[model samples]
Target: MANTPLIQTQGLTRNYPGVVALDHVDMDVKAGEVHVLFGENGAGKSTLISLLAGANTPSEGSILVEGKPVSFNSVSDAQAAGIFTVFQEFSLIPTMTVAENMFLGREPGIGPFTNHAEMRRKARALIDQLGFDVPVTAPVAQLSRAQQQMVEIAKAFHGTPKVLILDEPTASLTDREVDHLFKTILKLREQGVAIIYISHRIHEFERIADRVTVLRDGAYVGTTAMDDTDEATLVEMMAGRAIKDIYPEIPHNPAEVLLEIDRLTSRGVRGATLAARRGEVLGMAGLVGSGKSRIFRAVMGLQPTRGGTVTWKGSDITNAPTRDVIGAGIYYLSPDRKSEGLDLAKSSWQNLNIDLMMGREARGAMIRPRALRTTAAGILETVELRESYRPKAVAQLSGGNQQKVLFAKSFGHDADLYIFDEPTVGVDMGTRAALYRLISDIAAAGKAVIVISSDLPEVLNLSHRVLVMAEGRVTAELTGDDRTEDNVLRNFFNETGETV
Candidate 1:
């Protein structure tokens, strides 16, 4: 339980074919400290983590365990050395049960025969110990994102790791689930475990982090005690420049209604009512499973509506095909960017031209690569995505850059209404600023914009009016004097879950 270095890296470096992902970075974690790897996406935090976790070998420099040099050739080696990592992108197999996955590749038993009964009992005990109510026999694919994350954390505890690495542990969690996770972190710290935590949400640091290391563009900036630094200072280090503002002031000039939903009910949503007007930003706030996203998804034909009427500029378009909805000038950018927003295997530029590729704007014209490339480059420039990255596959880019590509894709369709759901979920502060400014610009340009987000500050700051949903319904609507945090949160758990 001594406050000594459990793991240390001296001049660690990692290189891909064309870029130095990590360049001579030095970092360390003490036996019981919650050390944060603070950085924007692509700032080399992941690279450094991959090296420490033994997922990727370092090109140069050395790792020291208890003051002795060692090389980790594989993830098994790192685990053997008492390091366990839960990556941001999940690696859980879809078909496996939670208990089976927890003991995967190392089931308990002698040689070949596995002890199934013991595995189930141990998995249940571990879940109970972690304070997560997950069914051990449930298939991981059937679980929600937050539950899956809990399972990942449970896997780390099963082996009693000396060092634990968590990447964006609360990105998809509800406020209640996040509270549980924080409690778990506090418990682990008391057990003298060294934790390397990564998150874009800086507010969580004040509560848990002992020390923080900042990385900017693949180089180490500095490390400081959490008590000695502020969020602004950390942001400056991560961006390598002073960011005076995070959210831009948006203009609101409400005009005619562009879209309206009357008594909308989908799979998880019920009796939701809302409207989008031109020249304004409509913000929706809710806990997970609250039906905020489902309301919009139903409008786009992705979710079937059991009862509702969607009117587009005075035309009934309820249950319309997604193509017809898009054709009607309503562009919906899904929150799941990897699956619904972009083609990961395609180049950034190609992903940006979904409108043209699907004939939303092509309109039987001959496909011109040069023209598309020129247009895409211009749009990507506005979002601050570098020109060099245009030719690279989006899957190869960092989370922040991939989000920029997804945002840039909306420019292709000159839509009357734009729906951006969790637009800045996993991005850095710099990228978030750019996207916030862009959202403001879209509202100023006389287009109706709807922003659905879990970040309460984002919803309160950007929207002229806010709608709060809980348990498949809209519980409250706030405007002007009613938009304070107290009012919003008070309605988040109203018993009725009915229309305001």
Candidate 2:
């Protein structure tokens, strides 16, 4: 039985109270192969992984592991069966150290005492193997988002798993880290491991996926070899439609300067000067930790400015609190959606109007719950959020839906100047197009928009003018003929001494 499939699912289905998450799906993975699951948000990819990893039970299906039918009632059972998973949402305990989190329930022990030294040694070895530099003794909460993601990956690989399910594993990783992960995946594949990879990034499929299976609206679509199917076919299969243009055309009319920064300096930013005008989309491009985010944080008053002058409508607003800036018709959308953008535990209606209810204007006014709900409903409609999901907690919704709520919340402010930081991270292609259209609409309405993104094509297509950052400094400004990916990369590499 050398050719026997490592894992197989027949008629797999999952159901929530009011939703059919997965419906009569059939899939299989061969030993020593990467089987990618491609689908949009809310298309049942998460449900499939959750069932396979024993985080959730399938309502109806049969799972066969190595030609034998097996049942997993808990994560421990799945682990015992040599199955492990790294989900999109992290599962690490924030209070625990990296080593402790990695070997949480399976810590090395001698008789009745835990072997702390051995645990630390194993954790350090794994981290080094993954090309990560996180300290083993450091708390998970103290690490950066990327570092935390690396820890999650390391934890999944702590034991030699026969089947590894990775859902959006590269969502927070940089290019170098992703390369390291690919190398590790290849090594694991050589050991006859079965990999179930799930991601929305189409470019990654060709590089890492051996076979791809498509799903739509909780139903199985089809499966194809990676070399046989192209990106266009994959997108059509995932979205069930032709998405011609994801980014809208930029408006040519940019009026008088709305917000201007002169020699701004902050904790993570060096001397930076920039200007955003009305009816224009100003794109910011840089690598991670290159200080692009610090500039926006300084403008929004989230970070203290050491020495800078921020002039908005000819008035100095430097060092002003975030609430005051937002009250003045300036809004900032944070990159970290789960932590800073939206409250996951709160309902969509609550998060949609929280800012307005807490604003200075509402301090002395009489509260009206009915009117607030009405207004929140209207905002949700404007962002195209489904009516049924308005009452559900934000955490229950998909990543794309949560992002829509963030946009709806920001749209409720009717701000004149909007700063969006990585607005579409971890979202599907269809949701990305909708967000880009919304951003364009905001700029077309005589509002100033600044979009900071790591995606070079996104910046190049959506910006009327582009600003390149390197090592906390603005390296080059591109407009007209210079607004291209090659030019931006050249500027981005100037300080790093790396070639494009």
Candidate 3:
């Protein structure tokens, strides 16, 4: 990697209506180096990248490209200046084919008409060059999230970009897909492409990063070489405090069974069978599309159950209405919080008190805003969310705070079973620590907690007993010595969903 900088910022700052999203911070990206940005969810990492990509303008300071200060008014201007960013959210049009989306604005043509044949030919060649298993003719809506991620990456290479920004590129990918992405990043680095990478997965930094810049609370912390920093030091730098242990030690004591799924089948799920006890944290591990989440969605009536029986405390509640399931005291947190778990437009306190506000006892009664906030503060405090954030819209809070508010919802109305699906999907380690503590507390209080996660360590360290799901069925139930990684992951490939 060259010492000369391809892109650098001089006191870059961004301000929102009532917040300084990114304080004046200076950073640089040199040619042929993978510079990783590390921070908590609200630490201004996304804000800085957005300003650099020209999706938003800075409230102060300037951005320098090749040591020349350049003003970018739009993403087009940034792209024209050899900068490209693939944000975490997919930007492709759903109805368009992969080939069409790859060359959306700059379509190949003969005279004034588009040359569809030539466009597909180049698209196919590019996908094959990247070694991604994607069909160029398939519509973007029809492809899985991983395949769509591949399309987003391939689209960025349409022009020879001097600076490529990737935000959580591997969050939705399988292990094999992540390997392919790592290889692609290395190849790009060898070709002199300066890359700015953002991810919460600490394990990936050692394999891909040349240097790391740590940010906290929207301010600059420091930058250091990957070789010089270990995981403990890096986490401390990102968190601004040394965390002795991220997971809490809680003893598991069994109680009566709270949930039982007998031959449960739903969309993307096979005949799944499982049982949850009141005083245990049951971990579910699987790759994406492994049908771990579908089984519960079926029990909740979010999806139709073809043939199965959902027994809650020995009562047959199969295909029960969602409201009735909630009435029976089951809280299910959706993986996609923005669309399903929360009403982003509402204030934090309002969302936190939604279940109580709509409960039968309070249906026709008047609600006092001040009293509601006062009541909400007690619940929010348990999850470590501040009081000042209670009145603001949930959309304005950081991702960690938003997730805390979602977790607090379960506290508003007590439940017998708490089903957290992908509980810590996007938060940093600090927020994850808080959430894990809450889980340990809930389980200690004798509530059934089912944690479904793709992260292996999360399942391994947290669960008292882990149930491995493959192709939508309970393939293996591991306890004690059987919870080793080799034993658990080996069953993921079991096509029959039965222990060999």
Residues 1-500 of candidate 2 have per-residue lDDT tens digits of 13788999999999889889999999999999999999888889999988899898999988889989889998888989999999888899999999999999899999899999999999999999998879999999999898999999999989889999998999889888999999999899888899999988887888889999999999999999999999888888888776556667767679999899988889878888999999999999998878899998998999999997999999999999988888877889988899898999998888877865764253445557787777777778878889888889999999999999999888767788999999988888788888898998899899999999998877888898999998888888999899988999888866752211
Cα TM-score per model: 0.92, 0.93, 0.88
TM-score of 2: 0.93
Q: Is candidate 1 or candidate 3 better by TM-score?
A: 1
Candidate 3 overall lDDT versus native? 0.88
Candidate 3: stretches off by over 4 Å:
15-20, 59-62, 89-100, 127-150, 358-374, 480-482, 495-500
Clashes of each: 0, 0, 0
TM-score winner: 2
lDDT of 1 by residue, 119-175 (tens): 999999988877787899999999977789888888877887889999998887777
The models' CA-based lDDT, in order, is 0.88, 0.88, 0.88
